[model samples]
Target: MTIAGAQIVHEKLEAAVKLLEVHNVDTWLILTREGYDPSLPFVIDIETQDTTAILINKSGSHQAIVSKEDYETFKQTEVFSDVITYDTYMDEVFLKVFHILNPKKLALNISLYDHLYDGLSLGLYHWLERLIGSNKLREIEVTSEPILKQLRCVKSKAEIEVVKKAISHTTDIFEEVFGKMEIGMTEKEIGQLFVDRMKMRGVTNGLGKPYDLPLVCIVRCGLAHRNPGDHIVVPGDIVIIDFSLRCKGYVSDIARTCYFLKEGEFEPPEDVQKAFDAVVDAITQSIEALRPGKKGYEVDAVGRACIEAHGYPTIKHSVGHQVGRATHDGGTILGPRKTPPRPQVEGLIQSGEIYAIEPTIIQDCGLPCILVEENVLVTDEGPEVLSKRQLDLITTPYKGVK
Candidate 1:
């Protein structure tokens, strides 16, 4: 039997209620409407329709308030015990729901300070105030930023399985591209090749959710992750490809760096191999330290220190981040130089969470980096890698052979 993450979400909600109890907040409210010019899609796309509002109390009793049309579908999710359907307007229902619960404090998802938690729009906020009908629920404060962040950081077993499936497909596509590499191929051509191949392998239609399948699937040579030119692949040019997938909400990010081999030169240079190993070593060390009780910034520093010790260029980005519905899944870094100390690292490594640790270390000038990234499940014992052995550099044995 498959373990649905509905249990995990409910468990987290219970923990959140406890957290609110400590703060003396009585009720938590999560309002969802069709977003306006969304910067990014919501992770909980399946939970609600165009309009939905969830009311959870300290008693652990809750209702998923949605339109009448979606009541049947909403009931199927089983996340909420009662599915309350409304007719035309939400004003009367909204007020009555709050009045009965009469929470001392109602936690809403309105965080102006943190961009990640700031999902409520200005228009929707105005609408919410309209429902207030001249009363200020400022006392009903907007909390749950921390709860939302922590909940998403931790991936459950069900989440891990879905991520694992997406990553395996990614692995197959990456391998196929290596076998089908062409010397004179443009970055556009090679990048699209994987996208085309994914279709053939039943990645989207087979998997369900139709993500653009990594809008920026990049294949670059020479200077990678920079202004990667449309240069023709030449011998000694290190080709690097960064790919991602938003599979049924969970996202996977993986990058592979391959060297252009001549008739004689076969494997990657010894120094380059060392650089690649260092990238893996950094990932290995970071994954070992992951658990339910570590600091986020502190974890990032560990990865940074490892990369720098090898005399590699410190990645401009963090060591690793949260992976859920979005690619750069959550805020906070495992890199040494994260600005804000997101102390949620240890909590993030809790059981049922999924994360990707991809460290890109530039070997030398004009040389491509050994970009190594793979998804892992944070288990009670340790982390499990979803994407398998991508350690050694994959080189094109012979050009125009496939």
Candidate 2:
């Protein structure tokens, strides 16, 4: 898929220009050292050893000041217009570019609110202050949270396709396990099955470490993991499983629940189905409430209300989050928190952004917690459900042979 290729970088850069104009900022500065900042992926492809500063102007000019050793590497990316290299210090090249651009306002990646935009280190932040001269820094420096957040949150056509592939592969793995899972299998055994299925599909862990199982098949009432004594799956036990993985660079996070029934049983227990219905209701109402220009808190409130109205306790976390490069890729949140919602949370939902709306209900009525997370995209018309929605409770027949 040429994941994070030059084309994606160019597209994001172009979007950055429009976003900067929308925010009325003249210059966007991405300062990084040792890749501590997450926004570096959007600006450059090559790894940087020393402090690198990328200057993107609202007038559509891209200039980069990188270490001499990384100059050729950054230049080969074909995304930046001009690449300047520095050996001893970056002060000379940094001032040289700023003087030429002569922008009155500059956007820096420093935010006390959103962690996604708070990529710049305190040491680098102070170094930039000393380098840019105190007066010019004051006149120009503004947080780049709004501009970069919008650019990263909104998915392009190509990105959406990659996300779909990830979701599809995840669904395939879950379907295979549903057919083969047995009542005597332990949680570890079930987890291995999911891993084996993912490997068979040609999707492995894209992280630095080896592949890890992504299952959350809790069997005992309210217990998240199996104990050392080996708790096995049994009939009448509710199993809630969550599976997610990265295909190419995009990620898919999804979950579903099923009930193990005794022989001749065709449906789930009445109490379990009622709780599952509440979870489905939350996802449906939340999606219906999703539209461009609505705030995160408003959308989250709708889902939370639905869960509570159905006689279930509301989920503690936010209703959902923007899904992209990272699982919790920061952008617009689905709901507000008790800590007070930031501007990122209150920001209007824009079309082309993807979010995972997960509303969970912890049932105290002998049923396991029902948590359903689905991926959706916000469009001009409304919300478009990306992953195939789970409409009914999965009923797996149990032979009770164990």
Candidate 3:
């Protein structure tokens, strides 16, 4: 492992120890083989070809048991105090570690809510049950969701830097594509412009397929989430581009609205401008509500209130979601507080967490909906906006002859 990689592992392990204590877990066990656990990267930053057993204790000690071929790699990470190797069967060594630790409560990578915390496959889980004996496994096994919720949600200094770079690159691509857009260009063509730029930069789409991204929605006919199609940009059309990109395992998501000016027009129509302003106001209020200790639904309500105050219906989706390794890196969800509120929405906002706050306004009169998204970093002092805010609608001239 590189020096930086080792440092990240060290930092994560330190945090994991505290989390284990917080959850009252005596130890956390991660088991993997050819298909490694999804959470493995955050722990060791490497994959093992053979079955591997990683144990982390609340007492701030960690150890790894891997095949002989993978032993040296685990040692180089320097995060584990002991790197034990096995020739073939790891049953002996794995059980011996459990015997030595004798943890009363053991957490496993199983979750009812977050898929990121549910990395252990059914087969592997059964294998563990047999290895540890059914009675003992049931007595100790608990979900690692609580620990993982914070571990993945809270951004380290290095993770934040990578996300910022992704945001920067995404915004730059948006600028170039919007500038080159001409009336009569199909939505697919406009979407391809972004794909082409991403290729030049050697980055991949953060959330969806390459050709399907930047979800180009031309007003009057286009809808959100649907892949860009053959709808042509026309004069007087309002366009929405929802774009995201990934860099070094981190991702960014952002959306912007643009207006194609008709002949003799220098700005958007009055109604279009009103809708844009309302969406921006909604996003602003949501950001202001992003403070540590606030629940996800509270922040969502602030933005929904803004939309309603401006005479628009509540948006169908959440106001925002945590963004990180995955586009919708799971944790807290800034969404509605329903009768049976989801556990995710009840989660408290914390410092060092990055969120993609998008408040949308869909029009009933066939006008294009307005969606403006911004990436925010929650800090102790206040919310810091990471992406450049789209304060006003992007206006472009119609090149087609009248």
lDDT of model 3, residue 195: 90
Off by over 4 Å in 3: 1-4, 209-212
From the highest lDDT down, the ranking of the candidates is: 3, 2, 1
For each candidate, what TM-score against the reference? 0.83, 0.90, 0.95
Instruction: Summarize candidate 1's per-residue lDDT along 158-234 as a digit string, tens digits.
Output: 65667787787888888888887777766766766777876785655222235233322233334434433455776
Each prediction's whole-model lDDT (CA): 0.65, 0.80, 0.88
lDDT of 2 by residue, 135-230 (tens): 878988899987888778998776788788888887788788889877877777776777887677777642233367655555464534332234
| Error at 312, model 3, angstroms | 1.3
Runs with alpha carbons beyond 4 Å of true place in candidate 2: 1-4, 201-210, 219-230, 336-345
What ranking emerges by TM-score with the best candidate at the front? 3, 2, 1
TM-score of 2: 0.90
- RMSD to native, candidate 1: 4.2
Better of 2 and 3 by TM-score: 3
* Candidate with the larger TM-score of 1 and 2: 2
Angstrom error of the Cα, residue 309, model 1: value is: 2.1
Model 3 misses residue 354 by how many Å?
Answer: 0.9
Residue 169, candidate 1: Cα error in Å is 1.6
